[model samples]
Target chain A: MNVVDARQAVTRAHREEWARVVAALTRRFGDLDIAEEAAAEAFATAVERWPDDGVPPNPGAWLTTTASRRAIDRIRRENRRDDKQREAQLCYDSPPEPLGAIDDERLRLIFTCCHPALAMPTRVALTLRMVGGLTVAEIARAFLVQETAMGQRITRAKAKIKAARIPYRVPSAADLPGRVSGVLAVLFLVFNEGYLTTGPDTDPVRQDLTAEAIRLTRLVRDLLPGDGEVAGLLALMLLTEARRAARVSAGGELVTLAEQDRGAWDAALIAEGHRLVRERLAAGTAPGRYQILAAINAVHTCVRDVRDTDWSQVVALYDQLVRLDPSPVVALNRAIAVAELDGPEVALAAVDRLEPDLAGYRAYHATRADLLRRLGRSQESRAAYDSAIVLAGNTAETAYLTRRRDQLG
Target chain B: MQYLISVIHDDSTLATPDEMAAIDVFNDRLQAAGHWVFAGGLAGPDSATVIDNRGAEPLFTDGPFLESKEHLIGFWIIEAPDLDVALTLAAEGSKHCNRKVEVRPFR
Candidate 1:
């Protein structure tokens, strides 16, 4: 292979195999920091050597073996402690077994990283780092945090896991529901960090983050195919991502769902997402938050025009979602649907009640502005729009809210 | 795994006779289920004292470690396989004691 082809092969291998190699090493060493470091060193070696010697036939296995050997070497050199000696022996003696088609090692790593004992932010950082194979710098950049802060957060989380003796395994069937939700929440939050960008004048779509979330979700679903909520979450993400192409106009302006061309939507993703939701619903499992949200999105996809949208069905799904997860954000979304079904006057009352909880949220102010404008309360609408404009982060949202305020004047 | 179920309550409060009876019944249930390790109730926080030894000489002080309306009134060290079991037992304990309970696993 040419130098460029070798580099491309290594990059592809890193993307596909980072988690597997790290997970295998972690399973052997029983230490996340060591495993991660070893895996990173393996990749660095690959970057330097692959261009000279070309990529291996089974790159994942090659990386796993390389990382494991490196870990053994490091363990031997670091200490003569009993535990270190035992770990080094294990790493040196164990042979690389072929992983199952489902890759349970990666699933175990996911569950461990998303353990309930860890704080939620730690869970997100760990998931992004260990499972998504994102660099600390990349994750920090994505979240708009300082690299040192992000690095310290991940280090503290790993220390907590070790100090607390959090087990490295998938939860039992009884504990699966609670534990799996933590994992799913991390994945969804990562996607949202990408999907709902608040950066000024930047590309709103974060295809990399969203794609990674979906990829990890698929891995989790394959491991737990019978899990309705998993299917529901994947379906929700896929359905939401299907509109990536149409959510923004060619001029980089925000396109409301009503104005976006349906032709720009990804039909394959929509179909797959709809099928997953339908299958999960048809299985007669009680609908969870993701299921309800996916059903709501499925309703949106059913109609060509926004006017043809089934507002009643959307409102009913939101009602169910509010029951499932009564967060302020969900309540805000439900209010929007309530406006569609009951009219802006009633929706305004609902929004007002949510003020104590959501007053600082940009979407809350934006929603209130829209409702006020619909009610023909131009003065109140302008004030609400002003608050929204001040709170808005991105140029698209600020521009849109500014236009609304100017129109009211 | 083992967990401590701390029953927190107002420092000056005391359980009624009815509440004590309910707690006894809940204790019997825990023992029967083989989840019970040990249980005890503390005197009001007024009887507590604090000791600080970071200086050259240990200094003894009279007062609870924390000045607050609430204190750890009682606690139970229970043995269970995992957090779920410990939390379920804690829920039962909370209902029986008629008090808020906090559950934490022994590290």
Candidate 2:
């Protein structure tokens, strides 16, 4: 290939191996900002030099080694003029080895980014930017927030880490359980954003976001075995994600669970989720929220059709979940299950309790409208639909609500 | 070893009656397991009176410790073998309460 073509190939290769390379480099260089800078510099250096010297046999390893050297060089250069740079210089000079040698380092990075010390929004932004490799603008776009706002969030998070002197090292074995759960919560939120996209232009089914969440969860599970919650979360996400294809119609209208085609669900993910849920249950420990949610999803996935779903069992699980993690969101979900098991009127009352907390949440209003419509309260249903339409983020959901309102009219 | 698992969050965010009853069910499980020592959901932080009796006349203050977004929501004293077991129970409390739970050994 020509020089231009070779450079293009190198860039592609770098993008493909970006996570592994950056992760290994981050272990060597403790600072995320410095590690990222070094990794970029290494990739750029390769694009310029690889055309003449020929591509390395193991490009990821070469990039990692090169990034470590570049980090050391930068530190040394800074140290020449400043005494304070000496500590950083020492850290870079004897950087940690690659993945096999530093099993816990990447997990530490994940935990640090998702640290409970930081706010929820900060945790999500930091995780996506640092681990998911999403650009600031992309993350801003994903959340429907201004780019400047997202940038400030990330900057503030980094500052907090530095100011608090939060070490980049992995947590001790004693602290691992708590820290790991925090990391999983971050990833799960990221996936939820994709799975339930409320953006005006984009489809509600965010396949890319869902896929990334699944991949990260799998990576964490592999690194830490016998982590029931990790497996539970992965299973939960997969089971939910399996229904993506049938979540909405080709016309971009929302399809309720009962109407969706069972065949369209991803059977592979379903099988994997089932296996994990079973394994976690067999561990003989109390089920966490993730495990409970996974079990709930498994119940849904295992049913032959939506009508066949064990609504009573689902209601029981929701009862347990509401007890386990009593969020307004969980209450709204439980209300839906109650609607199926009991009647729309009972569910409507249950949903009413959530109105104070979920006033701004579109799904809450949308579900309320459905329950009202089922009870033949046409005017009330239309009003509820109107609220949902106003709060709805995505075009698909807005359109779906609009149709429901029209039907009521 | 008994450790105290203290629920700490904004006083305004206290769980409602239904939610509190759910927590009662969780404590029931713990009690059945023989890990529960004593647990109670506290009233608002302002209801707490801090007394400093070092002076001739006792000085009194209206609220709980720490002036911040967080407050002492509630707590449970449970017996566990070590920090690991204590933390596991703390995690359970945090999850069940849907809030932060600080696990500290009883002095």
Q: Show model 1 residue runs off by greater than 4 Å.
A: A81-103, A199-203, A250-252, A322-331, A341-343, A349-353, A392-395, B1-10, B15-40, B51-58, B65-107
Fnat per model, in the order given? 0.07, 0.00
- What is the Cα-based lDDT of residue A284 in candidate 1? 92
The best candidate by DockQ is 1
User: lDDT: which candidate is best?
Assistant: 1
TM-scores for the candidates: 0.85, 0.73
**lDDT of model 1 at residue A73?**
84
Candidate 2 lDDT over residue span A1-409, tens digit each: 3798778768676545666666676666656666767877888889888888888888878888888899889877877788665574344332232334236555666777887667988988887777666778988988879999998898877765654434465566667778888888888988988888867778677877788788778878877877888999999999999998888899988777888898999999999999999998799998989999999999999987788889999999999999989899999999999988889999999999898899999999999999999999988899999999988487767877898799884
Worst 10 residues of 2 chain A by lDDT: A93-102
DockQ computed for model 1 against the true two-chain complex using alpha carbons: 0.18
What's the lDDT for residue A272 in model 1? Answer: 97
